[model samples]
Target: MLDANLKQQLQGLLTNLREPIELVSSLGDDAKSVELASLLDDIAALSDKVSVTRADDDARRPSFLIRRASDAQVAVRFAGIPMGHEFTSLVLALLQVGGHPPKVAPEVLEQVAALDGDYHFETYFSLSCQNCPDIVQALNLMSVVNPRITHTAIDGGLFQAEVEDRKIMAVPTIFLNGETFGQGRMELEQILAKLDSGAEAKAAEKIAAKDAFDVLVVGGGPAGAAAAIYAARKGIRVGLAAERFGGQVLDTMGIENFISVQHTEGPKLVAQLEQHVKDYDVDIMNLQRAEKLIPAKTEGGLHEVKLASGASLKARTVILSTGARWRQLGVPGEDEYRNKGVAYCPHCDGPLYKGKRVAVIGGGNSGVEAAIDLAGLVAHVTLIEFDSELRADAVLQRKLASLPNVKIITSALTTEVLGDGEKVMGLSYKDRNKDELHQIELEGVFVQIGLVPNTEWLKDSVTLSRHGEIEVDHRGETSQAGIFAAGDCTTVPYKQIVIAMGEGSKAALSAFDYMIRLPADVEAEAA
Candidate 1:
């Protein structure tokens, strides 16, 4: 079950195990169970400290638990084959359970250890989902850290009956104590905040007591990472506040156009970006949302940034790279049925709708690509476009046309997401050419329209374009003095990762220039 290269790598990693560990599997006679047993045997053969056992915690077949042989309390489990994106999760669980210390921050580890009450977390995930690995790994680590917490990462594709019973149409749906906790991507910090009520307030108090930074970068995308690193390299105090470290990049599927890098996935690139930024002395404020941006009362004065945590940070210069999010089709029932039938990620949720009819909205590259990807797993795909013709590249259009299970409809506007109050039943759309309204019965709706700038919070603070993007000059400087913006949140023509990194660097340089030219008295006072 394990390839030669993978076995070699796992052999090297397993040698780091400081203690013995056991793989307790509850499997059946199914093919997947046999495959899992083979994989477990391969793993046990890799290291002397590893062994396999039997356990019957649940009826789910082909599942196993990785526990310290000395103590079963410190354990984590996988309810399916932990391959694809979840392979890393499996490796981390093995290492962590085998007595190899995790690399998480000291404070985060303490928080996990301090968590009280019983936390039996069950997370549903798809193999292709880029966002699910983080959730699974986080919960797995938490379960290992605290005896009260137990996490089981279940594969939604393998257990269709449970998924249907729960009405889970999205990937990474989490349940705590048999009740819904959250859906979609969430960070460990965010999870702790929700579980530990005082976590937010304590974090806020710590942030409020910090000294004013020389540069405060808002947003944790590639642009924000670049800006923070550039500023920190100057030996200046830099603080970065963001909702999540990766921003929209976490949702992106595959990236091939990044310069120098031949090919990569969004989550992998984000991990690299975050690690590089951490190499510097920059202070990172994770899982923080900037609620408002206040300009300095004077030309060379401190600027204030209010956060949703009820904390504020002051900085001499502020760089905005909040980025953009997937644009929603603002139609009736769209909000009500979100995650019930309406989804924005094709790669993550496509597997859950196997052999089921689905609709893809938009005619751009993303839409065409989603249609192509879904045509293989789903029974049929209907591509709906508001444009008179497809706006995707000719190559993509040609490939989409060759698919037998795909049906394209141009000049169509999505009107309402038809649902039965519990789940999606179908959708209604308008034909622009014939002025006729039509409805299509589908089990799922994949939206790939485009992106909207995450500038709603800045609307009352800065000058925004008519389309709501932050307006900026050539140097990435915004309308406000000593304030700059970059990436998809700005009026930049292209929204590529490489371009965003370049713009972020330029914005950092511009901020440095602006600081140097400030009045001598102001500089001294700031210093």
Candidate 2:
């Protein structure tokens, strides 16, 4: 049932519809279908501009077709219930079909409007995937801007056969022109760039020439962006090579601890980060991944950073800020129920499990924090840790313990994810001390084990910790003379954005100091 506040908000938004819209449901006699139909009925009852109708089952069941009454060519479809975070996608799709332009940057809209050729985007997603809606909405907006482009959002749970046929292992996987286009969250500009320039051809063209800079910052997260900005302020040539500019920040949801701002989202923060970096005289290279690091041949000589795109860049100093990704449990049924109910990000998917029971694996700072956060939204939270004691800070642990709805179980190792082939139903764990296996029924499972640093490409070039984190000193200097490391990829104690930004500044300063100490000839070449 929709909350009163949400219903009021929907009513206000729907009243602005310029054209009448029809919702055709091809639902079966299932619980999900009945619930979705009721939700649609409530939405239709809100505005005179909206109407609902039953459709033949010749198409996929549990599906919906949203179209404008004035346009017969409108064929936007939602393959499953648009609950959870996906509800936003449905709202935006309705607005677009009702003759409303999406709220996009003017430049982005111009680029989208100028696009030629028929581009079909088939985006597969789960309701729990927070990053999925951004991509889905972006593609839908593109379709609205140009008739040559059309997009369809497919729910992975309802379309199991299609997901299996495509061998899709993750949510928010997009297929463009009948081939896999991209995975996870992506910016509208990046998506347009990929479509404009054929992926392979673009890579070859960008890699054809070797660029040189005074400082090369790898990774485009907060750390790398800060490093590039700080170094660029020194009036030296700076280059940034990154697979995607925001790194793990793209996966994050609500961020309240980022200082000044009271609240913000991952995509919003990323847009600001990119805009700030662009404000500097930095050569930003997006979608370029560093494949290898070649150390300088001599002291104070230029070092080479090889990219996965076949391009290489030579720089006098380099700052390694390649971030980390969430660690996953290699247990059975874990992969199968990825987006169905097994989630990695609590902020992104927590609301989906509202009033439902869920379990969080691990007891570290991240895990306990997730548990505390989820407790507010979920009906019950079971926090399981392999260690006897929780590894979170005393304050966080205290806060977690205060939650009446949260249950903390120590010395428990997650064994397997229990699911019904389509969605997670529960989880199995073993008592490490007693060696007894037990199962707990829940709708969602959040894995907050830890993070894995993205430093595989730097193993041969820099010193690394046993866990693959780059080893760095207080000044963020790595073992290599002219190279520095920062952020979650380094030996930094914390993985917060502010800490990474500060470390990036330190790395840039350290690189600048190193360059100043170089011989006159080398410094001149660097400049």
Candidate 3:
């Protein structure tokens, strides 16, 4: 199951093991079980400190536990083959269990160890999900730190019955003590904040004590990272407060269009951007959501930005790059059936609807791509587009046409989601051709319409367009002089990563120029 190149890499990584660890597997004679056993054997062959044993103790077949030989309480379980996006999680579990320290911060390690409650976490994940590995790895790290906190990462693709029973249509859904905990992509700080309420108040106090920055970048997407890095390189006090450090890019999958890089994944690029930013002197604050933007009361004065955690930051010039979020279908039952049957990420949640009929709402690149991807896994894919024709590229349209299981409907708008107070049953649409309503029976609905700018918080602060995007000039300056905006949240077109980065750098430079041109008295007072 493991290739030679990968085995060589794993062998090098396993050399970091300071202590012995055992892989206790509960497998059967099934094909998947045999594959899992083969993988376990290959892993054990790399290092003498690693060993594998069979003991069908877990109710979930083909499951395994990575337990520290010296400390049995420290264990993390995986209920299926941890390949695809989850391969990283598996490797992390091995190194962590083998006494290699995790990459988490020290304070977070303390917080994990200090937790007192019994948290039996079961995370339902899909192998193709780009966001599931973070949740799995975070929980695994917590389990290794606090024995009371145990985690089991279950592959929803393998346990189809359990997924159906739980009405789970999304990836990375977590259950704590048999109750729903959270869904979607979550970082370590976000997870810690949920379990440790005091952590928020503590973080707020720490943020409140910080001095005013010369340049403060709000949002932590590509634009925000670029802005922060550019400002920091100018030898100024730069601070970045982000709701989540990768932002929407974390949910993205393939990235073939990013310039110079040839091809890469979203998370991988975000990591490099973050590392580059960290190489500078920027003060980074993660998991900090901006609730309100209080522009500078006067010219050349500090602009105060308030956060959701009762913390406020003051900066001479602020760069808004909060970016955008997935646009939702406003139809009835859509919100109610979210995660139950309605999902937005086809790459992440496609496997959950294996052999099931589904509908893709939209005809753009994302929508058609989703239909094409889903056609291979689901029984049927009905693509409904609001436009008269598909707006996807010719190549994509050709590929979509080649798929035999896909059906396209043009000039139709999704009217309502049909559900039986549980999961999705079908959807109601309006046919422009006949001026009549239509309904299609399907088990799931994947909405890939597009994205909306994350500028709701700036509605009362800055000049916003009719579509809620921040109105910006050519210099990346917003309506306010000292405040600027960039990326998908601004008036920038294309909404590509490269464009965001360039705009971010321009906004930083503009802010610097604005700062230098301040009144002499204001400059002296600011100094």
- The C-alpha RMSD in Å for every predicted model, in order, reads 1.0, 6.0, 0.9
Structure candidate 1, residue pairs in collision: none
Clashing pairs in 2: none
Q: Candidate 3's error at 403, in angstroms?
A: 0.8
Determine the C-alpha RMSD for candidate 2 after optimal superposition of all C-alphas.
6.0
Candidate 1 weakest lDDT stretch, 10 residues: 53-62
Q: TM-score for each prediction? A: 0.99, 0.74, 0.99
lDDT of 2 by residue, 1-527 (tens): 68888889999998768889999888888887888798889889888999999985436778787878987455477788887778888888888888876767686688788888888888888776768887888888888777778787888766777766775646778899899899768768779877776554555566556467889999999999899989999999898888988999888767889999889877678879988988999988778878999999787888998877676788888999999998999999988898678888776567556678999998998899899989998899999999999999999999998989999999999999998887888999999999999999998899999899998888898999999999998889999899998899998897899999999999999999999889998777555
Give the CA lDDT, 0 to 100, for residue 144 in model 1. Answer: 93
Which portions of model 1 show Cα errors greater than 4 Å?
55-57
Clashes of each: 0, 0, 0
lDDT of 3 by residue, 295-320 (tens): 88789888999999999999999999
Candidate 3's C-alpha lDDT? 0.94
lDDT of 1 by residue, 1-527 (tens): 99999999999999999989999999998999999999999999999999998776668998998999999898998998999999999999999998899998899999999987999999999999999999999999999999999999999999989999998999999999999999999888889989999999999999999999999999999999999999999888999999989999999889989988899999999999999999999999998899999999888899999999999999999999999999999999899999998999999999999999999999999999999999999999999999999999999999999999999999999999999999899999999999999999998999999999999999878899999999999999998999999898999898889989999999998998899899999988876
